[model samples]
Target chain A: MIEEITSTQNAKVKKWQHLTTKKGHQKFHQYLVEGWHIVSDALAAEQPVVQIIATGEQLDAHQRELPENIETFEITPEIAKKLSDTVTPQGIFAVMDILASETIDPETATGAWLLLDRIQDPGNIGTMVRTADAAGFRGVVFGNGTSSRYTPKVVRAMQGSQFHIDLTHGNLEDWVKALEARQIPVYGSALNDQAEDYSTVTPQADFGLILGNEGQGMSERLMTQTTTNLYIPIKGQAESLNVAVAAGILMFKLNQKLA
Target chain B: MIEEITSTQNAKVKKWQHLTTKKGHQKFHQYLVEGWHIVSDALAAEQPVVQIIATGEQLDAHQRELPENIETFEITPEIAKKLSDTVTPQGIFAVMDILASETIDPETATGAWLLLDRIQDPGNIGTMVRTADAAGFRGVVFGNGTSSRYTPKVVRAMQGSQFHIDLTHGNLEDWVKALEARQIPVYGSALNDQAEDYSTVTPQADFGLILGNEGQGMSERLMTQTTTNLYIPIKGQAESLNVAVAAGILMFKLNQKLA
Candidate 1:
């Protein structure tokens, strides 16, 4: 039977609201996925979706598409608004479990991995994850100081690519050492005298690419650990390219050589 | 002498606040550039910075960087917060005049040009403009249905690249006709049977690249007018690339051939 949640104070409703924060997400081991597109992608990928919550209108519009086994809750418009991050609530959301099984043992890892160091903007972090997926990256490791992968904004911007790709959180330095021990080249994106032009390095089937914080490039210690650093040359007066865009260019260009 | 604005309702303060909206920006032919990095870039580029407004601390910290001829204002904290779009306000802003004189005569245009069609995200729009600048594109044109170039969010994301490149507004269909008349090749970023892999086509010194709306790509009419459409192949399960990221990849790759 489909349950109805008329009060925002209901235990389930309050618990769902808690998913909005990192601490709550970590404690509950769940995050909220909003909008039809994302929710549909989650279902298609067979991710663990705990419950589908929606307003009466949204339930009527999309109930037919949902799996029969999943629990459903009809919530009030007020409750829907409280749970939504966007101005116009899509009125549909899914409580999804974090991919706890996808953690990588870096010593055993191979193929291309994207390592992010303190990427601050939720949109940039999400876009890089999605781009890494599109470029056929094996997995993504969110280094220290990076935004939480399960943050509502990051989840929204990732557009379900998170389900298709492996994501793990760890110290990037340790991951670098592990990959290096496996004889995989760890490339750092840094612009300095010693950095080689990205075009000069051919993309390999197995490698690790490290991108850095928005304001600061890769930390000096991390850069020192890289096998080599790469830089994208700028021909015009603009000082730098948006980090996400740079990541995209590098990912695709390197992957293109493999093709 | 530096004027002071203690009231949020001060005439100049109110006028500056209005620039935050698209309609007001169009009516006033001005926009606000915030943050020291962007404001300083605007000043260095010799763009028409009508006035420099800052908190007393900011004014004291950056007074030496200001050009001697420009007018200055010290605004109250409340007024600064009212004018800022960010959470932690930078407490610095420049009221910059729109480039009313830089409209393109497409028939006589030469070198590379980036034409955008109905891109809605301010961050995406501004990042594309900045990317175009870094790739040494001659200009950027905002087509019908796109976000306003002078919106505060767009201006902020652009990071003062607007000062380095020629930005204009026009009907893309008209611009297409004009470029075709001049025998300049026009490329559309679209995925269709006729579209070629972007890697196959060499980037030319003089060409046009048109990117489209986030949800719906370039309109059918505009696609029909292009010399050729290009597609960046995705190797993994992800559906499509972020529009700004795709543009960056294309711009730099095409520009690399030029180098």
Candidate 2:
């Protein structure tokens, strides 16, 4: 079914405008993804995309590829601009169900996992997710204070990597305890006397790596809970590495051929 | 010496405003850096900080620490906003000379260097430069299409890394040729059957690593001219790593230790 929305104040348009915020996505349990690439990726991944919204021209361009079972709406440029977060709207969007993520038990968990604590930057969060995907990690746990994956800014920066891996919201403290109970080494990144030099730690078949806030290192409680903390020996005068960059180096180094 | 400027229309104030653009910065051979942190770092590095501009409140806060020889201007908050690039003006700025970067002869270049081609994003450029600093690289060369490091957005994102290492603008192709001529391996990053896995290459004491535009890989002309090209294995579905992240991974991996 297809409908035309000429006015910005239309009921459906107002509802979508709300999906631009985290609060709205949480309240309605739906998320909006913009641009052609992401929309097409969502469809390709067989995500639960319920609706397609586009300008008449964009709808005409993409109509043939869109799933016929999904409802479609042709909206005016005004409404498109009003709902867009980008400087120029791509004139297309997909409304998706925010599927609840299931928890993975550490006792049976295999492969590597990344745990982020209090990572507030959307770009950092999204980049880390993408890096984790590229590094072939099993999943990423967003600890408290870390921005939700549903945040529109993170969704945009993620560039579609969210669908490629598992993302779960959890308390990092509990995660550390659970992983440690199973004897899966959980490593926190920090620079201290006791921290093992990262390169010296052989690639592991199963592990959990923790990264924290941009300004602060890992939380005191979480840092103390890990099996051991790892440090990338800083050879230069730079105080530290960017959190996302550090995540990439550590994930690739530790997750090599997770057997 | 201190000068009080009450109005935005003051001749000197108008000139400082001009430094906000590339052309303006080029014409004057000077650039403006905001915030107390940058200003102090510039002073600490003895980087030819000719003038300091700050609001009365900020000037009062930082007065005792400022050098006696450099000229200081106490401007109103209105003038500070006029010259600030950030939403909330830090109310402080330093004007520094754009020192001409002498060409480095590859024969004598001892440490790893990063060469960038067509990297237009300011944040990516700044982040790469900082990563090079953290990885203990000797310098970074901006090829033709990369935004100048003097751009206000790049300067701000660079934090203080700009002062810690050398920044040179040059042709990446020439850099590849020069390094190879000196028996130093110049590596290009590309994913192909023939490209050696990045991890297989042992950390080197002297080499050049080339990164290109975010979307496009290294230029065809440059790719074929390298000593050899390297590839970071992407074990999962992510198409590619963020340019800044890739640069970080490569720099740290190759420049692990100078010896």
Candidate 3:
């Protein structure tokens, strides 16, 4: 039903807010997506979207192209402003069920996979996913303490790469062991002197490159479990590269072998 | 001289606000750098600081660590807050002189360089500088109406890499011609079908990798001047990668051959 929304206290508005927040995302097992670009992407991917809410002006703007099967609601700019997290709301938002991503059988994969450890910033996590997708990575696994994969900032930063690849969250040790069992080599990044230049590591038939957090590099416990610790040589005066940039560099280099 | 900063109308506080506006940055040639980590990074880089101002309490907390050569001043917390750009300023702020970047005799350097075209985000520019530093790029040249290299967000995002590298802003044509004269191949990125995969272009003795804006790719004028127009292979669904990430990948791959 395309109902008109007048009040900010409407149940639908509260639901949208919840979908945007952590508790709501966890309780409902769904997250909010903003902008017509993201909503259009979700529809194009045939992903399950619970609801679509847009302003009268926006709906008119998108009416010719919006799919008929999806449920939609109309709200005023005031209602939309209140519902949006952005200062300049894109006049559209959607609630979609979180996709269930399982560990890939590395034995069958042809490209590299990404392992993110305690990568705190949502923007970094999102951008890394986008980079990984562009570099032809098979999937991305979030180890213990990484940002929520479904956070709005990350999803936006990823620019819909989330829909294109497998994204999983689980224990670090088990994931490493799983890759090993499949004969896939896993490399951890470390700041130590013994670490080989990242380019030196030949990306295996199916390999995983782990990137750590912003403040700290890879955790000592996680580092010890990996096959090798790799380092990107820093030629300039900066202390270290941002984790996402480092991951992008590694992923790109690994893909070069296949190219 | 330690001054009492009671009102937001104080000359220094006004300058901080001015840094936010384009005319202000143009007129003053100064920008704000917020947060403790960034300020500490600037100090560590030994960037010339014209004024180092902090609250009396903050001075008490970090007085000994302040550089002996730099001038220091203490203001009230209220005054410090007025001069700050962030919601929660770390109680330290400084006015640093912008470094004058020298032109590279593109003929002499047989290394990788980055040319940014109309990429507006300051954070992206800063992150790209950090990535360029990590990948051992010779320097960065900005053209095509991009944000100033010295913007506050770029400064904070750069994490002090700006101090360690050469960054210039000006015409794109001359730089390309200079590099070509030196026999250095320039690879410009675009989405055209005639463009080869980025993997196909071997990094010559010296090379220029051009990254375009987020919305617009490379301009036709600049593309025509490039030795080769190339595209990064997007194996999956992503239309493109972040410019910074794309640059990082290209630089890493090119530099690996040299390393």
Candidate 4:
């Protein structure tokens, strides 16, 4: 039904805003998604969409394609703007239940896994998830200080990779130890003098590659716990690389080692 | 010299705003820089520093290290806030001369060169430059419709690669033709049946790899000009990658071919 929402005081508006906070996201296990591309991607992934709100114009453009049982409503432009985190709202929003996090059952471990250590930028985190998904990584784990996977900017940038990977948030040390316990080698990238060149490292059929913060990189304690330290050699003038770019290069190159 | 700049018409204030425009940066042959890391990197790169401005308590903390030849000024907190593009000014700003874009004579291009075709995000462009620099690309060219190299955000994101590479902005088609004339293989990344897997095709020592716009990717006309079309095989659930990340994978892998 085309329901008109004009008041900023609407319960839905407040709930969407709450999704912006990590506590709200964790407590409710839901995320707010905006724009046509994200909404379309989420639906196509068969995510448990709690509700769909569209502007009158947007509904006219898209209603014919929506599922009959979907909870859809046509909201006012003002209401849509209030619910949007983007500078230019696309006149659509969705409340989606969190995708089930992938369980690290050792019995099913066969491919590579990506571990993010305190990656702070939401955009970088989202891009990494997208790249990891494109490269066919088994799953992604966010360490302490990492951006929340449910942040709006991340959700927008990820497009739809959220549903495709087993995403988990935990302490890096504990996760590495857990992976170690399972007989998986844990490798962390370091700018250390003696680290093996990243291109030279062979990817284990079952391994965890840890990427660290943009500034501090992998913490000293975490770096010490890794079975091996990998370094991407710099041949030109940049002292370092953007964390996401470096991680993507390593993930793709490491995958090649298997082939 | 401490000067209270109340009027928005002040010469220095006007110059700061002008740097935002391409015409202004071209006329002055320099641009504004913001924040501590960018300013520090620019200084450490030993670029020609025209001036440094600081304000508030942070100015006191930063003043002891000011070099004699470089001009220095102190602005009121209000003035600094007005001049800053960022939400929180880090009590520092610098004006540096733009490095002259020296053309890479075609005969000397013995390594991978990045040919960007209308890539637009400043952060994406900057990140690509840093990655290209790290991968030992000969240079990075900003083709038609690309963002200016001197934009503050691009310069900051580059983290000083601008001082280290041949970053030129001009006719991309002409450059493509020139490289082809020299028998240097120009590989265009495109989605076409003619495209071979990027890993399958060994890059010639003399090669120019072309990247396209973020949205449309390589244009049909540009694809026609390529010596060959190459594709990075996507094995996962995501549709595609951020253009810069894709470029990094190509640049680094292609550089490895030469190594």
Candidate 5:
């Protein structure tokens, strides 16, 4: 049934607003995905979309893309604006349950995996997840200090790649040990003399690539535990590459070796 | 000489504020670089630092790094906040004159050149410039519709690489023709049947790599005129790579081919 919400104080509107915060997301086990593209991607992937909220105009424009079986709410433009974070609201949003069941056991992981070490930026974290999916990596592990995967900015940046890959949150130190115990070589990205040139390393079928915080890079303690630390050589004057760009280059290069 | 300016209404303060906007930057032929790292980079590169502004604390902390002969201003914390766009003011900024004199003539361009086609995001534009610098590209040409190189956000994201390379603005169509006439192969990044895998192409000493806008890839009219269009193969489900990440991967891969 289609319902109309005119007041921001409506129970359903209040509930959706709660999903915007981390604590609210945790309490309810759901997060909001904005815009038609992300909402449609969730529906297309058969992910659990609790409800879709949009203005009458937006619903009319995207009726063909919306699944008939899913419940949807039509809100006034003012209400839609209150639900959005963007300056120009797309006027569409999907409430999706957190995809935590797909989390993998590092001890039994068999394919390539990406380990993000305290990555702080939502855009960087999301882009890395999307790149990991493009590289055909089996999963992504978010270390302790990283941004929450369910944040609106991150979900927007991931572009629905979360549905295509396993995403988990855990202590990176333990995960590293687990992967190593399974014979999956773990490589940490760093910029020191001890770090081998990334291009020199041969890619393998299964491995763990660890990327660290943007400003500080991989923690020194974590670097010591990896099988080898790799560095991308700078050919020009730029001191370093953006963390996401660096991650993409490394992921694709290593994946190419297996191909 | 060091001078204290307690009021935001000071003539110099008013002028510096103007540099924050596009029209002001154009009128003064100068742009603001924030944070200690970028300011130091500008001074170290001798990139025509017009003046430096900082809170007394920042000036004292960075005394050793500040150029002794350059004009410096000591501003109050309130004034510093007013001059900054970030939530937390870095308390340091440098007014650097535009470095457009180094613009290369495409017909005579002899090194790798990055052509940005209407890329909108300031961060994306800046990261691409830094990546180009790291890849040892000679220069970057800002095509029509690209973000202004001198914007505060772009300058911050570039992380001082702007001082290390030549930045020019011009019509991409004309630039492409000029580069081609000089036998400098121009490559357009696209996802289409006619596009060759980026890995298959051999890197050359002199060439132009065109990256398109975020939402729309390269303009269709411009894509058709390139010598060859290249594609980065996506092994998994992501629709595409982040523009900056894609540029970085392509740049480093192509640069590696030459090495």
Candidate 6:
């Protein structure tokens, strides 16, 4: 269906604006992805992109390539600005359906995966997702207390890496138990005597690596459940690494591809 | 000397506000560090913290430990808000002098160092500095076009890692040439057929690693100048890793402590 949305106060526009917020995303079970790159990625990946809204100029430019069935709206530049998070709106946006939570069967789950334990920064969360994809991880789980993957800032940060990997939210403790039941060693990140230097560990084909909150680290309960926690030895005066940077290092270290 | 300045319009308060800008820091060669932790870190490092400013409440809380020789001022909470970059002002701030740039004599230089080529984000620059410190790098050279280390946002992101190691601004072309003159292998990050996997390169105590602008990667000229550009082989679909995260992986790869 094709329609024009000229008023910023239109009911549909108001609903779309709500998708920009966490509460709105949760309530509507939908989120917005702005810019041509993200919208194109969603379409190319065959994700559930339910709608595409763009300024008339943008629609004219991309109209030929857009899929036929998705709902399309022509919006005024003013309406575009109302829905924008960035200072300059790219004028193209998509409404993506949030994936429903599904159970991961211990019997069938394989390949490396990343788990977040209360990792709250959207930028950090997004970077970790991209890094996990780059490291060839099969998926990432947003554990309890972790920000929703559907948060606009996070979806923006993931740079369309979301389409390349599975992202879901679940209790990390349950994730640990599942991976363990499958006989895959799950690694938690921390610094202590029991935490082995990350480089010393042999890279594995199938494993789980859990990164924790920006401030407090992995919960003690989850730390004990992992096969072993690993630490990237800090050789200089820096007390710790940025959570995203730390996640990148550990993911790359534990999941290098076999030649 | 200690004095009370109750108004945000006071000359000192006005000047302190100016210090938050790039032009102001350049003109006066001074930048402000807010919050007690950063302020205290500056004092402990003894990094030419010339003036201390705080509200009466905060001053009373910390006055006993402040150095006797440094000039101190008491200001109203209104002035505190004026100087604060954060929403909730910590009520303590310090003025720090920018270090004078000195020639890096290639003959005397040793140990791993990071080079930034046109990298502009303060947060990325600061995170890279902290990662450099964590990886035990000797220093970082902010090449031409990179954001100033003295930028308030950069300093805040660095979390005082600036004091733990050397930070200087210079032309990266000269830096690469200088390191090469001393028989030090300088590596630029990029992925091409000619580039070697970062992991294949033996870790070195004396080396230089160059990271480039987030979007463009290293300039083609500098890419050719380095001993050999390094590539962290991405096994999956991410277009690229976050610049800071890439730096963390490379720095840790090239500068691991010898057993």
Top-DockQ structure, candidate number: 1
**Each model's TM-score?**
0.97, 0.94, 0.91, 0.91, 0.95, 0.95
Model 2's CAPRI class?
Answer: medium
User: Which residue pairs in candidate 2 have backbone atoms (N, alpha carbon, C) closer than 3 angstroms, thus clashing?
Assistant: none
Interface RMSD of 3: 2.3
Model 3 DockQ, alpha carbons vs. true complex: 0.58
List model 5 lDDT by residue over B1-259, tens digit each: 7999999889988888899899988798898888998998888888899889999999999988887788889999988898898999989998888865756677777788899999999999999999999999988999999989888889989998988988898899999999898888899999654699998988878889999999899999999899999999888888889999999999988886343
Best by TM-score: 1
Q: What is the TM-score of chain A alone in each candidate?
A: 0.95, 0.94, 0.93, 0.90, 0.95, 0.95
Tens digit of lDDT per residue, candidate 2, span A33-123?
A: 9988889989998888999999998999987898889999999989999888888898999899987655666556667889999998898
Could you report the Cα RMSD, in angstroms, for every candidate shown? Answer: 1.5, 2.2, 2.9, 2.7, 1.9, 2.0
- Model 5 TM-score is 0.95
> Of models 1 and 5, which has the larger DockQ?
1
Residues B55-115, candidate 2, lDDT per residue (tens digit)?
Answer: 9999889989888899999999999999999999989999988877646666566688999
Q: Native-contact fraction for each model?
A: 0.76, 0.62, 0.81, 0.84, 0.75, 0.76
Candidate with better lDDT, 1 vs 4: 1
lDDT of 4 by residue, A143-211 (tens): 878888888888888878877877776677877787788888888999754788887877666788999
Once superposed on the true structure, which residue ranges of model 6 sit more than 4 Å away at CA? A257-259, B192-194, B257-259
| Predicted candidate 3 versus true structure: per-residue lDDT over B81-110, tens digit per residue | 676655776787777765554455554655
Per-residue lDDT of model 3, residues A123-168, tens digit only = 8898999988877887898887998877778878988888788887
* lDDT, candidate 5, A107-142, per-residue tens: 777788899999999999999999998888888999
After superposing candidate 1, which stretches have Cα over 4 Å from the reference? A257-259, B192-194, B257-259
Q: Candidate 1 versus the native: TM-score?
A: 0.97
Off by over 4 Å in 4: A99-109, A257-259, B1-11, B22-29, B44-48, B56-65, B98-110, B203-205, B257-259
lDDT, candidate 6, B76-137, per-residue tens = 99999999988889899999987676346555678888999999888899999999998999
Candidate 3 global lDDT = 0.78
In candidate 1, residue A6 scores what lDDT? 98
Question: lDDT of candidate 4 vs native?
Answer: 0.80
lDDT for A33 (candidate 3) = 91
